[model samples]
Target: MSTTFWIILAGAIATYLTRVGGHLVISRFENIHPRVEAGLNAVPAAVLTTLVAPAVLGAGPAEWAALVVTALVSLRGGLMSMFLAGAAVLIIARQFVG
Candidate 1:
């Protein structure tokens, strides 16, 4: 096999072994700390918020204006209204800016 093929195969095997080994080792633990468990439970929500917050808020003035409009629309109308606001803002921005 080529060197690249061997490297990829090794990486895949290593990842599989690490994941399986982790599960095996974790199963042996009798008790998980309550704080750690709580933190773990919160991790997914935190990650999702981190992922989405930036996309919703990160931008220049035009983007911020659109986000504001969307938020207002969302509060008054619904998701579709919010989407329409964002799309309308983007179209308006493109027309004016570029």
Candidate 2:
């Protein structure tokens, strides 16, 4: 409706295209290199660690608790599940622990 809204919408579209574009290009390959597949599989854990490191550096008890739960969940779950579990723990703990 506004200039800012249009900018945000355009950014969202561009981001989505960029994210999918990589997969589209990669999917054309009949066989992926093992090293490439390993690198791709590592991306999620690498992303998680980078996101966690800064927060953990200056975090309190609630944040630490959530991070621990997230790490534990990560061993058995996907990124979204671990994130949601961590968020829920953080929110609930913050209400009391913080």
List model 1 lDDT by residue over 1-98, tens digit each. 89999999999999899779857976989988899788878977898789768776656666777878887888789878789988899779867765
TM-score of 1: 0.46
Alpha carbon deviation, residue 6, candidate 2 (Å): 4.9
State which candidate has the highest TM-score: 2
Q: Report how far off residue 62 is in candidate 1 (Å).
A: 1.6
Clashing pairs counted in every model: 0, 0
**Candidates' TM-scores?**
0.46, 0.58
TM-score of 2: 0.58
Which 10-residue window in model 1 sums to the lowest lDDT? 56-65
Give one digit per residue, the lDDT tens place, for model 2 in 24-97.
98889989899988998999989878986887999999999998999899999999999999999999999998
**Stretch of 10 with least lDDT, candidate 2:** 47-56
